[model samples]
Target chain A: MRVTYHAVYLFLAAMLSTTLFTALKLFGVSPNLFIIYIVFAGFYVSKTEAIWLGLVFGFVYDIIVGANVGLNGVLYMFACFLVVVSCENVIRRNNAVVTFIFTAVWTAVLEGINAIFGPVSGVWPAIRIIIVEIFYNGALAVILYLALKRIFERLYDNEKR
Target chain B: MRKLFGNRIFVLLLTITISVSVVLGVINATKTKSTFMGNVAMVVITPLSDACTWVGRKVSGFFGYFGDIDELREENEKLKSEKKELEAKIRKSEGTDRENKDLRALLELSEAYPSLELVSAEVISRSASNWYESFIIDKGTADGLKIGQGVISGENVLLGRISDLGSTWARVTVLTDSGHSVSAKVIRSGDLGIVEGDLSLSKDGQCRLSFISKNSDIVVGDYLETSGLGGVYPKGIEIGKVIEIKPEVQGISQYAIVETSAEIETISKVMIITNNPAESTAVGEE
Candidate 1:
């Protein structure tokens, strides 16, 4: 049941990445909704659930973005692993600061990988884009956290039954 | 062993991810088209993507289309008036004989390429990043769209080409993506160069004509057309015009910035050329 729910969620994420996200440009960037979801799962869900979500959605992201097929899959799964492993013992109490740090670190690791592997002309230009994107993602995270929390709260309550 | 078996899903996921990553890396290095995986991804993802794009275009187009339609109508009127005025002068020159010859020539030019039968499709989604420029069209392999087929806007305007394909959807990488490059010529001077999308200029609907020879008699306001050298895009399709020229040295031009004719940002509809003259003949024989 949980897998089905997440599979539907993953498909919806792909749809958003391709269509609605194209129009929702701010600071020349839209929030990486999948990444946000991964971070949320890492913080709020079980370790296995988080890993599975990251792996599946990361692969989906790569296919939809139409870049190299496995780049995002590997990178996103690793991001989730790092976040979950790091935060599991550390940030169990404080939701706000932990979410901020996790989101920022996730953005940094992914964007950093992107800059190195990206087909840009120079590292500085890549760095510039990455920094702007990271900030945009950071700002968007605040808005999504509570809404995501509420939505997942219901999801959790249903699963409990 | 039992605990490890239970925990080993993560191990299995990581192993699969790494293996796929290496395989994809090799594929990227070799530049092989993803005939299998690409088709699968498109087949699975495109219908959903297309539905979303359809809703997005209609929802957004519902309100935005009114203003856009009016502006386009005005532009269309001005162009029609200019063409009518030209036709009137031509009619006065040699009566029906000259017009008949011109019409025949126009027909022959279209026949020269062979794939005059175009399939119209609505754009469902555009690449959502500055790093890429591609869109999903509502037609696919089922519609006979092949990889590397030419995509166009109007009758003679160059848009891009179909880059990837599925059964029901195709992805078009427009001319403005930094990764996109096409062979083209300056219509006025006959100077040839590869027009590539510049990442910086693409944001404003522009690309750059690169590797232009030094001795070319090129200047601003010169129009460009596809040279058809790559065999991907059709020949003589209007691409854009030179807006600025940057000189390499004395008596040598390095490159010129060409503004694309297609308003790719706001464009919502496009056509794909599924059959070239050769393919049409092959089909005719079959």
Candidate 2:
């Protein structure tokens, strides 16, 4: 089998997610980088590819982090599929604002789905945590997306030349 | 029909991944011994986690180096003064040690119980993401730790249990985690209740005791300890204290907010109970 650049990108994304998770946890914050990467991949990659990346990342995440087995896989796959289906109609743009909004919405949806699976006490506090996490992760997503966009755009331009 | 079959490779990969994961889950759930998988997981994840932690520490240190020199000097002086005071205390403590040697000796008292064996280990890694609640310890099966072993810190305060045991590492699920539960008793009133976890309560570094009797005279300051009823943990290990007791409006039970004695975030050394009578009985009697 031919080794693909997509596989390399996915691996790099997983490693980046690990670093981001550790960094955020040090600051007493929890940011879902796997979810963010999956959403970003869904927007940029094919639906099938997005789902595959999500599953790979989710399984690696589950093994490293002990969560309810298959929970992250299911959540990531569903989230990526949703984003991929939605982004097909939406035109691709280099707008940071759009990326910010998408990140916030994605984070909120992921947290909402997680709350449904787990025992969440006091809805208001849970909602507050979800909002704070969304804002934190949304800001992170903006920075990461801008950087990756520039890099990928440069590479594509070079390839064309 | 063409569109349906367009993503056949992806669908096939997804099917295989899900099937394999399901099989792994079933095997994990049924297998009584978690040593093999636990070892493999430790070998795979620990080095990565350690490297991440190292990078985090380096980054934090790099940022911290930009602090004002005056502030740093002041902090240094304060630490020196505190060290001097500690040194004086140590000297004085040695002189008066003979008179009150046995007083408030929790460790010695804990040693009187033959069913308990303690193996100390350091917390090497904490949970990486917010989704999971677990910690990895430095010592593992090589240190006499096995799956289902109870862990405690700071004067026998219950931390969690060893959920996964490897050859040289283990994973501990803290009592503040949503997935953990323990059969606990009110130390003051001798009332039995179940201690469940709320990850939200972890902000205040506390756990919750649920299913407490409404009629039970559990005051705000009442102590809570393990009941040893579940055969998981030994009896009389301090868990926490009742900080708030709210009787449920509908049920005959009250809910308690317990402030854990062990500082979960700051704890470095933990003792794993290896020779509990309950565990031995469960294994031998079975």
Chain A vs. true chain A, TM-score per model, equals 0.86, 0.77
Question: What tier of docking accuracy does candidate 1 attain?
Answer: acceptable
Q: Write the per-residue lDDT of candidate 2 for residues B99-147, one digit (tens) a residue.
A: 2442334355345554566677766667645544567788876778888
Residue A74 C-alpha lDDT in model 1: 75
The TM-scores of all predictions, comma-separated, are 0.77, 0.73
Q: Evaluated with DockQ, which candidate comes out highest?
A: 1
Residue pairs with colliding backbones in model 2 are none
Predicted candidate 1, C-alpha RMSD: 8.5
Q: What share of the true interface contacts does each candidate keep?
A: 0.32, 0.16
Q: lDDT of all the models against the reference?
A: 0.70, 0.67
> How big is the positional error of residue B12 in model 2, measured in Å on the Cα after superposition?
9.2
Q: What is the DockQ score of candidate 2, to 2 decimals?
A: 0.22
TM-score of chain B of each: 0.67, 0.71
- After superposing candidate 1 on the true structure, give the runs of residues whose Cα lies further than 4 Å from its correct spot: A94-97, A154-161, B1-22, B35-38, B58-115, B247-253, B277-286
In the range A84-148, model 2's lDDT, one tens digit per residue, is 65666563553567667877898887677666554566686567668877888788788888765
